[model samples]
Target: MRRNTRRRPTGARRRTFAAVALILGGGGLVAANTYASAGEGDSGGRVQDQSGGDQAATISCPDVGQQLTDVPGEARADVDKALANLDQQITEAYDRLTSTRQEQAQDGNFVRNSILGPLSEKRTEVIGQIKIDVKRAGGTAPEALDGLAACTEISPAQAQKNDGGGDGDNQDGDADTANPGTGQDDGGQGGEQQDGNGNGAAGPFAADFVDITKVQPNVKAKPRRTGDASTGTFSVQCGVNENKVFNTDNLIVAPGVDNGAHHTHDYVGNQGVDAFASNGDLANAKTSCSEQGDKSSYYWPVLRLQDGTKEFDAEQQGGGLEGNVGKILQAKEAEITYIGSPAGKVVAMPKFLRIITGDAKAFTNGTANANANWSCTGFEDKVQLADKYPICPQGSSVVRSFAFQSCWDGQNIDSANHRAHVAFADAEGNCGNGFKAIPQLTMRLVYDVPAPVIENGQVKNPYAVDGFPEQLHKPITDHDDFINVMDEDLMDEVVECVNAGRQCGAGAGEQPQEPQQPEEPKQPEEPQEPQEPQQPEEPQEPKQPEQPQEPKQPEQPQEPKEPKDKPAPQAPQEPQDEPELAPEASSADADKDRAKKPGEAPDAPSEASSAPSDAATRTQEAGAPDDARGGETKARTTSPAETSDTGVEAQSEETQPQPQAGTGSLASTGADLWPAAAGGVLVLGGLVLLIHNRRRNMTTN
Candidate 1:
């Protein structure tokens, strides 16, 4: 359902409308007094109505980022001109269609013929010329051009028939013939009748605009479950960084309808997000998330708290507030759950899968509010009444949870109805019979707001919020949208990691360029020096005792003799060299090759390797600052400076004074062996002499 009609400018007509308004109003009022053009003035570059006194603005063309980039540079100029002209035509057509009463704007038949049909023709002509120009420019026309059409499309309504008279599964389908109004007209009628008795309606929320009870009984009856309890299911606790989130003034719902819905939305994740954003746009966007590989776009309407105390500015009219809205604060965190069945087997999400949850158009309209979700941070199980938007207490936050349809029909990434090709998963998060499991998406948004107090036994000064639809004026109209633009490789990793029950953090491990070695390598030097000193001490102490006990120093000789096994000494040298090479090897494969060569010792490489890990440990203990991980990773990479340090340590070891005990033991072992050999020869000579003398004496007898 659409809002009641007033003159609103389409996109290109925005400038003209402002100029005309200034002329008609005699320029006596300030710039804020004139009506804003569609898509011209809104927070976050998104067009939505503000409640106040001015006529609603309209949007003109799709954002340039949303356009097809398949057009060659030579044909780009031609396409741009055609698109601009098409935008003009479409905006004019939207103006004509909306030139009726509020009720007429919602008529499916009226909008289809007057607005969508003409716009489609214009779009078709432009696309046809684009194709012709592509061929003319010596480029093959892309297949995307065939499927390309207007994003501003309208559909005929086919209201579902309820067997239980407005109950049962009647709310399942998009085609519903129910004519639901915000009852803005009825409130005035009732007030006029009560005027004579001096009982005028106190405020908008006090009258017919406040009946969310009849509108969303389903949400009040049962809150939807969103999280996956299964082990190995992945969840990303995306921190709230409001500075990175953007607000644009482009309306997403009705592309050319100026200020069709008046509000603002907060956008996170993808930086290049706009209504016309395509898969390419998302893929190319720089994300606010730590996971650079995740290019999915996330957005939701901004929340405003009202106390019925502020006057309206002219620019804030049409959908402007009747009460004072406080300063908007970004949510604290968004808890995102990527659910899959049978743990770790989450299928890679299809590219450009668009998901919308909650009803952005359900302001003050009961029929549109059926599936809305609202609750307090601490009171998740006790869902508040539909009409009552909770004001959180100090220290607590207002929580909004969203569960998107996850089951898919396998072929269509999208359908005529934004949701027809998708269905809800079972309680276990398994896909339904006809549909296969896609990633089950759920996000919980937490907000900080002051609590409303009870006055005269009723809650007062509550936080009220809504979506772009101007007809709806209740906080129950919260909604959000997401578009998946993950890189193919990253998507595969996500599926593998989740199916195998791995807990993957955001940005899906998309690492930045290799970093330079860390500056804090000195910290590791302290521990390494002590460890090296102990190794040399072990052999020196035992060798000192060998020189004193020559024969008994067989033990000492064995000790010196050990080095005689030159191969054994060489083996220890290689392993010692390996630790040095480990650092260089860790950084670059080329360095590893040099270290592996038998001729060169990798002592420097060893120190280089230890430097980074030690530095990382210290950094982690110090509570790794946001940029520390990058610094640590870079420091781990071998640097020329680290190599120089390794050489210095080697030179120091070679030049250091040799232990006296080690030198003496070497000399003593050699000296002892010569004496033992001479003594053995002397004893053999004496035995021979004695045997010859005895034979001579026997002959004289």
Candidate 2:
């Protein structure tokens, strides 16, 4: 009943499930932090590794993937171009889904919306299959698509773009867009803001600010496949604003177990999700913590960083990302413009937000830090049982004792110059053990996309340009918007079924002839008075009576003319809450109702069987013995036999009334509309693939 309320999700839900990705201050950690990114590569492939230290020996697990973190990105886009194309397509789809509303308001994301109808679920499955298709093509298994892959190596130009320097309205501060492929500014890169590139990093700024239009993912297919596979351009965005993620799953280790150099080896790729560990490994931390399906921060250190830069020591506890950050305070020169960073992963999956407190130094905190692990998430914080922001995430921890070691290093240590602030804990509660920690800010940290598509078999990459937040928002909008249209199409089918039942079946007409009234029981002529015994006496006197017999008023009063004027009015019937007649019933009439059932046309020749099906049946039945055909004859129309119920077959074209063909103009317009999304998918993929591969030798440097 709600007017067109049912619709496909536009990935606006990602905003709702919004987890801020904060690219925090960079630095190194001690013993405990070093062990997080440990994966060893081996031929058997089941090979896994760990930080080669006492820490590695302490933590024990059966399988390697189990030891890895399940980050957000399952939807795969291996090369930079692939990532860009996917980003463009997703954003475009969203624009169609929520052209009229915004994410924070009405729209939901792919995962949530897909649950609404059949196609939604199917959409999710198709994407998963695509990942398999690409993997089967001999590509390296991708890092999880959802969130696991962290950014690394931003181009100088890309870094400047983050500073908010650009020309255009994006620099003016308007993030929301009704136009396809854009979104309203949410205070980050989505609004009017200076472009965050080159010298533009910090000019007038807008969160919705991004300029991906230069890439133009809104494309079409060519009449024929060009050898290079180039079809159309795909607009691309550079930052979080432009990335409208969807059904992100966990890109996994089906990739077989790996065993490779560890401890002192430079990681080949984003070591964040390696499936193997070195011979020695640090135990993944486990606390009584739970979040959006993730439990235990067992692989915390590795899952958080995508730089292929592994630097943590799981052995000493208070010395990993958090701890090293504390140390950076003392070791690094101060920047008046602190460019304070936020915790991006924590910001994205609200479920991961949590609160924790421990001593500022490995020496002071290690004693109690082992058990001091604490956590809380966005929702828990919202209702306020805890004291953190609803936007933060939750996680477990590994302290000094995790490696089965007890460093009673004399308590008076601030070697890291760390001081904790109540803000560091979670969306819930917080405690300051003296570590000056600022939630990191969200920013673009890397650029590498998927491979370009092949035309008639050659390669062409399309997503050549990158955009900022303002630029990114529109794409997300477009992505969702298109999906919404798809949702509408699905609903139209439901209405079609309902109409068929009402228009072509028995329900379309009056109930079969009201039961014919039972014939009034014939009454014995008012019982002839028993011939009185007088008849006996009369026999003897017959001779004398000859004269008067005719005159005797027939003793029986002439049966008074039966009264023709009165018959009890049929008792007024009670009101029945009648169902409204169907739209087609207006044509039904008594003449039609009397026809014989479809296919029951008597053995008579066509000319003689002139009566309609209903008429023939009713008339023929009426011709039966009078005792059986006592009801009054009446004409009524019956509905045509519907194939589902009566064996009646579909009528030939000649017998069917023609539906007005859609106008030529309307038909043409619809035809074009149908190809937009499909064509866009392929075009964007080809273009993005080429551009992404341009950067990779695909050979390890």
Candidate 3:
């Protein structure tokens, strides 16, 4: 049986990658290579790859940014350091794909590309296929998705051009590099990059991280249940080298830190949680990072995983998490944390979206308007909690904004919407010893993988993509209770017939059962109807036997549902991590924050919410982007610069008037947008349906 092939990166993304190559590299045989490791002749600070290992050579790019001149030690280390961090990510991803294609698993042994390997051998193949486009002039920069929203349309000419190029070939059309205001090839733009005398400017996307999505499998693994801890033997194995496991003898032999040990601050080696955020200021060991409450609001934390690879804070979106557990975009070493029922596998969310929840102001728009009821301190009904931060008994308000506000989960903070909280840090620098804020956050490319189906003593996903892995992503951090709840609300209705006799779209509502109840046992009206009892319509083909019914008794005799009898159950609330205390950011800060975007909204409309669906209304108010009815959610609009051709829009409650175009049909949240999914497409007021039957087969990354 044939299998589905992987969705290759579009020429746009590849070409963009190539352009990244051009801006970062120069004076080389290859003009645009995919990866950015410096070559043998590279002299500027990029680390040269001299190992001559199986690793493929990365295309080098010179550091090209407004304030940057020389490559930061960290960026160079990302390419040259221990284990070829970036290459390992790419190659390992492909190795898993090959295994899935070859059907090579046997019994209990699973041969996935381990931590030390590259993502794929196909690196050159995939990267080489990128397309390059040079806009002569008068071309505007196409918009990009915010941390998670999306949109996708092209100019009439580009659409025609794209259609012509759609014959299964992928190309990257990247423009060449020049100064922001000046157009020159004098190699001047390349040197403008930061001197690395200090950390460089954050890239539009995270820097130097690997994407594990290409190897994702469509089928989920049946969660396995191994023996519980009882046997006095507990084995903890992850993508770590044997050296990582603590050995009593080895411990005695090697008690000191090895300068040669894998981890180095400069390398973007780990992409787990926010490891860099936890680092001690280079000044000294005693003066390590002030508690989480002390670090600079703008410091770019490095996320490290249990396996040891890392991701720069800037690259969190696509890099997966930095730790082993709960990290969607993994950064480093980690032991499997919590797997849902059935064990070894999990159902991951489709997107890793970021959204704006609220600021300390009351929005003028309707309640459904993106900024209505925020938990911001000065916003209506919000209490001041900044003073209580750092659990300080005194001067509580003096705490770092995130600590007081609880930006991680909005409840602790003052956000109104749940989807977006705070720009990682927007509060005051009133606190001591903090760095500048960093915000050019963007999501990484990712895909799903199912457990391999077991066939003839082998187990694997039956539907693995031909060139991708059957399973990818370590495991999701959240149980997605919201998804569970939403699914519950729509489960019965999705399969039912609508009043129009059309199949319900997903779970819209339960069909009217009162009229369908079995006919009340009619008192046999004897001969009155005998005249019609004659031929019974000439032996009509037997209508199939009455279908089965639920265990509940007939509805007419049953009681009415009391949907709104009591105050409704509140939606789950997240804790806030920052307080609203600081001065607003500078224009420079605003420029850096405009990069991330949310993903697509559903391709349908929600109906107006009625009293009966008040519970869902409350859900929407709690932070869900959609209303309960699916079609009746609020509408949000964005500037053209804030949206992308892929239909994603990046917006924020805190930032003012960033670029946005067209209304936000963005159901922009997370891979597991459970609450919104249950309600379907809930625009604030009005929405557009972007879906058509024809594109159902088109793939989304």
Candidate 4:
């Protein structure tokens, strides 16, 4: 009754109630959409989404260097410096982005207006300078380069998509198709804890690692060997930067700029290598290699453990100040091996030829040139991860292997972009477009550090490779550099050993025997025919006369002794058998002697004796004409005996035969003789039967 008197259902009151319900429903829908967008763009455990719907995690710009394929040689220095400056600008911008997170949280437009705007302006000016430098040097600048100046912010999900989604598939189509760990963060520790470093930008988050044991085997089978394939490998024994040679300078990328890499590098080989080093300085520098002739410089990004330890470069631009903090981990083993091509025999690498394997900016620039190969020692054959770092088992060490481009352009030691001069072989191991195959430099770096613990999406004592601050110390950005400063003689040896299909290096002592084996077969073949008849006659003359005369003088009437002496003919056959076993025994003894005396130069003499003895035994087994060829066979057999006694004297004599048998065609003939000798034995047996039958027929007549 009271309501009926107070309000008679006015049209205004009804309209207000419906409007309020509509506003409340619309606000709930908007909140749901915002939360959905944040969840959709989450980058596993790398970063947390901001309240802004379209938040960005990093910056991505077009690679200007990839576009300038034909920069003039004269403009290279200025262009290189300018390019480095562009990198420096991006690093600075990234530094600012990390330092101003609170400002970004307060104002969503702060990153775009204050950070990205100034970065674009600076990049535009540097791009203009690059174009001018090229034009002044009589080279046409790419007009589209101006479009590459503007950069854009990208979400973490977008960054991962650009990098092949961390699926471990490289440009070669080889993939580590393992179910990587659960790449989800529980959102337990947000903000600074997300990156391990207090900086919000620099990171090697929990999502970046996968347990190696769980990874499925993904190593692609090597291309089958063709007739022209260079199958040998040459290893250089440069100690694993034991001298603590560390720097942030990249001589190959930025010759005159200090701290150009913006991350520390571990250096081995040429001791004088630095940003300021000239070609002459490199040539004169002392080396860390066991071979003094190998003065080549080899370097790669240093691995660091994020355990709150400050290093010598803690306050330096490329170290702690740039967010690459912590204790540097020296490689337990840094093995540098140069392998031959699967397509054809590799040519000698040009002196001072610069090679850079893997892209250092792969995180932001995309994975077009990414060649990172990460694994554990025991799991290398099972899985080679390109994007994620491997979590090794307790005893297994972390391994990073880089297989460099095997194809060279033949003309330039380096290109403007530092990549045009070299290229990777195809999946079939063929170099296309007239590219010549060169030694494929493969570097294997092993670290013996404790495994980092990842619990509830939080990583404890994480380890990462040094990289540009914007790259976030990603494993995909792992790279290596090399400059061939090897002396001409040493390089020739490497080429000869590789092309000849013989593994030769400081670590391979047995390789000397391979070359000698080919020569041994040829030497015995040439000297066998002429020396055989004379050698047998010389020894038989003394033995036959002395024995027969002694028996004849005792009994002249013993003419029947001639028949009895028939057994004596078999005595020569026994000596032939002894010669076969004697050389082998001598060679074995020589090897033992060399093994026992470790101080002696074992490679030269041991190979020399073993090779000739093997050749002599095979020749005797082939059944050279009896006592007629005995003297020559005896001479060959005695050589091993003499070598076993005095190694130095034997080496002097053995050296001459090697040069004479250098021709491969001649060496091949030695293997071919086995079939020829078998045929000869069949024919000789038939003749013996015919002669015996004829003699019996004549006696019957």
Highest-scoring model, TM-score: 4
**Candidates' RMSD to native:** 41.9, 43.4, 33.0, 33.3
Candidate 1 lDDT, 346-421, residue by residue in tens: 4567887776654543432233223334555334432333333444433345556565665677766554224555
The ten-residue window of minimal lDDT in model 2 covers 328-337
Q: How many residue pairs clash in each candidate?
A: 51, 198, 177, 6
- Model 1, CA-based lDDT: 0.38
Report the C-alpha lDDT of model 3 over 627-648, residue by residue, as the tens digit: 1011111111111121222212
After TM-score superposition, what is the CA distance of residue 10 in candidate 1 from its true location, in Å?
Answer: 81
TM-scores of the models, in the given order? 0.42, 0.15, 0.17, 0.64
Distance from true position, residue 678, model 2, in Å? 46
* Whole-model Cα lDDT of every candidate shown, in order: 0.38, 0.18, 0.17, 0.59
Ranking by TM-score: 4, 1, 3, 2
| Candidate 1 TM-score, true structure as reference | 0.42
Which 10-residue window in model 1 sums to the lowest lDDT?
156-165
Q: Give the top-scoring candidate (lDDT).
A: 4
Please give, for residues 338-373, the per-residue lDDT of candidate 4 as tens digits.
666655677888999998877888776655567677
The predicted structure with the larger TM-score, 2 or 3, is: 3
